[model samples]
Target: MTTLPRSYWCHRDFDGPGRGRLELQSMTTPYPGRAVTWMRESVRDALTGLDRPTFGIAWAWLGNHQASGAAIRELRQGRPYTFTLPAPDGHWTWSAHPVSVLPVIETCANAPSSRQQLVPAHANGDPP
Candidate 1:
């Protein structure tokens, strides 16, 4: 069976107090050309959803599953890096510069640890 390149990110509810959860996304391309096309669309879609110019970086840590904790640390330290995906002809590399690196919380499910805790919104009363 062929394996696909995967990516992960930690997500937390900014409106409430809770441990973050790990989110996974994967992409598989049979050729170098398709790999480049897939990555470009994926990155573009992600950037479009965000209101800012920053983006997060994730690497494939396991056999098409999980994220690399070591790589995340290196990226957090402001190190320049790139992730390469192998293809039949060559390879595809993707890199990004994020405004901030969000911390990943160790949790099996996406549930808050405490129900009584609630985080305050922004100072301007804007919904975060």
Candidate 2:
């Protein structure tokens, strides 16, 4: 169980559709390559449950330094609104708030795909 540095940060974004992206980075210097690799794997493992098509396409990326302030602002306004960086041991996690990002995950899982929206409307011009 490696201890996550205090400088660690995570960002999550939802495209309002079924797509979502997650990025993890660290602000501290001398970042260990092994630690970064572990972090990436840990994130992938954490999101394995969202592999279903209903969850849409979820992608995780690794960042070098702190994410831009603009990106953070945009994420805060999105469905995720918060994120967590968990240690590989699953014993500890860090976040600004106590809330989990599950709401965003669930939203993506339930969101209708573009193909589903292409259905023809009823006589009244309303969706059937």
List, residue by residue over 40-82, the lDDT tens digit for candidate 2.
4454655655434322322323342343243344334432213
Each model's TM-score?
A: 0.26, 0.22
Top model number, TM-score: 1
Error of 2 at 78 (Å): 31
Q: What is the C-alpha lDDT of each candidate?
A: 0.38, 0.36
- Looking at model 2, residue 115 earns an lDDT score of 64
lDDT of 1 by residue, 1-128 (tens): 65333332221112212214323334432233333334445545444333331333212212222233444554455453345444333333454322333445678467666633454555447686
Q: For model 1, what is the error of residue 37's alpha carbon versus the real structure, in angstroms, after optimal superposition?
A: 0.9
Worst 10 residues of 1 by lDDT: 10-19
Against the hidden true structure, what lDDT does model 1 obtain?
A: 0.38
The reply for model 1, stretches above 4 Å from the true place, is 1-22, 55-128
